[model samples]
Target chain A: MKSWIEKQKYIIDFTLSSLLRRKVKNIGLLILYALIVFILASVMFFTHAIKKEASLVLRESPEMIVQKVVAGRHDLMPLRYRDEILKIRGVQAVEGRLWGYYFDPVFGANYTLLVPPATTATEQAETEPMRTVVTENEHRHGPEEQAMPLVGAETIGAGNIVIGNGIARVRNAGKGEFILFRTHAGEGMPLRIKDTLSSASELVSSDLILMTEPDFRRFFGIPENYVTDLAVSVRNPEELSTIAAKITRLFPDSRPIIRDEILRTYDSIFNWRGGMMIVILSAAVLAFVIFAWDKASGLSAGERREIGILKAIGWETSDIIRMKFWEGAVISLTAFLAGVILAYIHVFFTHSLVFEPALKGWSTLYPQFKLMPFVSAEQLTTLFFLTVVPYTVSTIVPAWRAATIDPDAAMRHTGE
Target chain B: MIELFDVRKVFNTGKPSEYSALNGISLNISSNKVTVLTGPSGSGKTTLLSIIGCMSRPTAGRVKLSGREITSLPERFLTDIRRKTFGFIFQQHNLIKGITALENVMLPAYPLGERHGPLKERAMHLLDRLDLSRKAHSRIEWLSGGEAQRVGIVRALINDPSVIIADEPTSNLDTKLSYRFLEIVETFKKDGKTVLITSHDPLVYQASVVDEVVRLRDGRLEGEAP
Candidate 1:
């Protein structure tokens, strides 16, 4: 085993020197190879980071959200449905949620306004029910659980709002400042900014506004007994499907968006994005494969002559093939590593400029947050087999052809 | 001892370009002697040398090295015989470019899986004997023609094989370098190595160290030179 390793070491050293000798020729291929890897890896890293971010943010979300549907469109839900939902078995709690999108023509962006359950000073002990809801749903061990700030009646008083970091950045508003938006009555409704959401939750909370229930209802002109949706929590998670079915049967014109379904949707979205990227990149990959094949098949005169000389000097066919394999392995592995590192830096550190717009989709207010770096061993392995194996195999036919020829004839061919 | 019996090599057989390079040639190469084969460009001298060196296989007939027939051996065994038994010096001096003289000399030993320290030591010793130690670190392109050829000679002798097969060893050398090359061949002969050379140059054909001079014409051995 040691002797075999020593032989490989010698071959690798020789291969390195050989590659360095032809830097001008190999560098072009290396750059192209690394660029392709960088592009694909950046896409993978970006999608993986987005998926991770979604999972973290969604961890604390309600298990199910029941929305009333009218003529295939979501409509405001009546507060009486909460009582019906509460009576169902396995239904732990059902809270009426007041949330609606408010369009600010000034910034030409839409911000989500959410009115959490009332929290007043008179009921201090039980005042912050929404804060309890968020804390209860928080992940046992996650950065979001620690990073998110707890809100109460004092933090968000009537007619005041806690704005997301992205919204604050766009409106140039700070704590104790006022953000003016048009109400349903076409009148200006100015809400005082009480606090800003943490940057860590910016991926999901971007362009969000958290306010009191009365303020939200008054601003949107919603009826007193109406809410945007009903957030449902289940006592027994395994019976969630049965509860959802019961709720659906009770209200035929309603849709229950389960947490697991939302997660599956996110997964499918990312997978679809990845699939589209593969389709688009397929042409480039094909071009690259053809380029590799052409480069390998058309061995230059000097290269052929070199192989001939090696054989003439008593090197076996296997030796020549092994040398060629080392050469290909060295080049491909270098390109793969370089590309992956650059992609990691690009996606996690510098916000994947080329791929961010495509992956993030079109949004008026883009999140100003860095993606968490997440790469799996399977991804690295896939890239290795995809790039290195094909390249090394492409070299085999040409190397074998050169190695098996009569050394004298090959040396004299001139390969012009 | 090297012996060939009814060796025949045909090129492009059954094609319009079919041509026989060697025709029923049989000969013996004695051990520890400098034998020269002199012929014109198309007289099959190089082809015969290639077959004898195991660089190629004869289309027909048997070739035996030390009375062991190797004509029908597989390529793997043939490669082993080539590595362990013969050292080749081509007419072009076929030194791989972009490598140092020392590296070129050590190329043949790489496949042998020899340890680098000893391989380098052996190459340096051979280079020193050829007065090329100074140029050992220089790339092949930087060396003079004679220096490169001397490097090639050192490379061939690096393995210390018993047989040295040189094709037109003096073709690229001037009169002074030609004698220098022959002197190296004479040194190999003195070391009891069997040396076979093909050349039309009378300088090599008439060298004092040459034990026998065979002549060939039209792919047939004419006879030993008088």
Candidate 2:
């Protein structure tokens, strides 16, 4: 008799060839497995990439933000809170972040508004115009009309306020126009547009207007001493907690939010997505288990006899078991690879359109971004164990039965 | 060498209609000879063959093969005995229809733990001996009845088992092919290997090459005649 390893190789080789002989049947199984894998990989890849991007953004955000709470609702922080919080140790820089909400009647989304200082020449010109912010439908307004065209933070400058590009395209305003803009309080303010912002941000970039904090207060009828939130930068990263604690003690009305806490809120969305994927994938896996069980259990007497004959010819029960296991391995590995590739194309290349409908429910549109869906060795290893190992286990019972069959009874079995 | 003593095989144990398939039969088969076991349907010819082939064990008997008492052994150990010592040809061709004739022949040799290099060569050699080298790659579904039977013979002989058991190996073959198959069995016998076959055809009973014919009537041997 041969060594066990040698015997297993022969069995696996024969099993592979036998499967090749029934390509039609095996390929059908492969495709079915692939569909399950594809869906799973797609959802996993999209959610993973989104979380990765969000985390990257959060890591680069300010160390902490201070907001005022009024009966659990975030309200405008009084201007005096900044001076009091700044007295806390570990505070390096304190700046006001003017945040508000506005409704873009054209596109339906809870649009957050913010005011950041004009950091560039283009923005200096944009703030000069306190007119209507026209995003699209340019012909609806005269060319002389001053309009605030929403743009991105990167394009803000002195005397300029950039509204979101969505607002520009929707309102159809260009450079050097007077546009009427409304404050959160429904007060209309006239301003001359300097330039249109080129891009947007996930939080407020797409449908927001950025101006100097002082200008924002004047436009919204808020006091010079008022700010929606205060962004605090720590002199030492290690001092964040001490600074937060100090601010909490000094200013009871103001709450300091650490960067990680904000990131956690973002992180929870991914955890939810992950939980959903598990539930959905587990259902698919159950279906696959049933399909595989039915297929294995349904082997005819002739098939069982074939197994017996193979064993009688010197093949071990382990060999027969391995043969079936390889059949499963081939199917699952191929499906896994194919599915991952499709998911890659969907995430990185196609922007995950197919998945958006399922994931983005109630949102005006899915977030605009591309995902890398990086190939992590950990993920692949985990996926391999998830797919191939269970399938191999599933084949064991059937293979054992077939291998242990009575050779004489097996020899007598016919198709009939 | 093979021996059977007081072999009793009962089907559907401990039931109202329980009946013995093989009842307290005893026999011995010498190595390097041809033994033909024949009987009517339900006479336990197949049951006896099954025990001799190591496919099943006698419920209340002792069976010895190669001087080892195999009846008491676990089926796991008997598996190797069946693999290395017994080659079986059934009433049906029993070739896997999806595979080629050569693959079918190589099926039995798989347990020998030979590498592909040797298994393929051995399979090819056996196929050639059976005058099936040209049809080695032919699918079982495409093979003629004679060709398929020859494939079955190749499969049985590929592992070079010491004992060859044929259960109506000619049932599916025509007269010419049946005679040809018998001639092949005779050749195996001449090679000093043991051959046990069951057949209803008179050709087997009257064959000049047969060493002995053990006639069974309804599960009891009439006589072990020369």
Candidate 3:
């Protein structure tokens, strides 16, 4: 083992100097290689981190959601459906959630206006027998969908609103600024911005506005006895499907959305995007393979002679191959490390401004939020196999061919 | 002693370009002697040198070094024989271009897994012996032709091989450097090292240290003089 280490040490030393001999060419290859790695790694890190953020948002949601589907279209669910869902066996509590979108014509961005749940699950379950109803409008805001965290959500009063950073930034509004909302009755209802959501939850809260129940109902003109959907919290998580089935059966027009299905939907979107990025990256890798092949196959006469002399001076074919392995490894691994680090900084530190707009998929407002780094050994190994292995092989195979020839013939061949 | 019996090297056999670089020519090189193979171009001098130095395998022949037959050894063993038993000096002094003179000298020892400090000491010592110690850190391309050639010679000696092989050592050197190379060959002979040189240059064959001369033409031996 010591001997092997010693041998590799000297070969690497030689390989480093050999690489330095052609500085411009090798540096160019390194930059191109690193650029490919940077792009691929940035895409991967962003997808993984955003998925994790989405999952965290999902974790905060109720176990199941009961939405009223009328004529195959999502309609405002009646508050009576919440009482029915709460009566299912193993169902702990059910609360009707009111939420809708407010599109500002001036900004051309849709703001998700949600009424924070007034009470906790246990409180709601305890007070279910004495509760009233609500009339509301359904909107596309997946309550479990936005990577939104409502900090001090229920504290806002009827005339006060909590806006997201995106809303605040686009509307140029802040705490104490009044945002004029156009009511469904074509009347302007003024709501003061109590606070802006933290930048930490910017991923989903970018276009979110949290208002009190009375303000939400008054702004959207939702009558009493209706809501957007029913949020079902179950005592036993495994009974979520059972309660969801019971709710759907109790109200045949209602559709139940389980947390797992929501999670899977979110997971598949990111995974599909990740897979798509890999397919696109494969084309870059193919170009890299061709570049490596060009370098390997086009060994100059001087390079051939260098191998010949190395062989003539007691270097075996294995030694030359090992030396070339070091050569390729030094260049490629450096590029890989450089690329990954740059991508990490770009994705997590800089919010991946490059190409992230496309990745977010048609969102008018982009959240400026830092994603925690999501790296795995498996991903790095996949990357190593993708980039480093091919380079090492390309180097060693040609070196082996040169080293196997008779030294005299190798030297004389270069004589021409 | 190095012995070659009826050695033959046929290139491109079974093809239209089938050619024989070495015909069944037998020769023996006594230990501690400088033997020169003198011939015109295409006279099989380098091929025979390559075969005798274990740089290649002869298609047909028995090659024995110090009474051990090695003609049929596998390539792995042949490489060991090449590394341990023989040191070759190429005609063009093919030191790798980017590395220093000392680094080029240390090339052979690198693959041997030798202790680097001692190996470097020995390499530098050999360069000193050739009056190249001052230029040991100069890149191969930066060195004068003769200095680069001397570095090549020290590279051959780095592994402390018993037999030294040189193919047209003085072909690309001026008369002064040619004489200096011959002097280095004489030093090897006096130290009990077998030296096999392939050269047609009169300065190389007519050197005072040469013990024997073998002339070749058309891949066959023409004459031998002692």
| Top candidate, metric DockQ | 3
Highest lDDT, which number? 1
Error of 2 at A21 (Å): 3.4
lDDT of 1 by residue, A192-214 (tens): 98788767667777788888867
Backbone clashes in model 1, listed as residue pairs = none
TM-score winner, 1 or 2: 1
| Backbone atom clashes (below 3 Å) for every candidate | 0, 50, 5
| Candidate 2 Cα errors over 4 Å, as ranges | A1-6, A117-159, A165-180, A184-204, A274-289, A300-302, A375-378, A381-386, A414-416, B223-226
Kept native contacts, as fractions per model, are 0.47, 0.60, 0.65
State every prediction's TM-score relative to the real structure. 0.94, 0.87, 0.92
What are the per-model C-alpha RMSD values against the true structure? 3.2, 6.5, 4.8
lDDT of 3 by residue, B1-226 (tens): 8888988889999999999988888888899899999888998888888888877888998999989999888888888989998988888887788878998889888887888888888988898999998999988889988888888899889889899988888988999989999989989988899999988899989989999999998788995321
Docking class of 1: medium
| Ten contiguous residues minimizing lDDT sum, candidate 1 chain B | B217-226
What is residue A170's positional error in candidate 2, in angstroms? 5.5
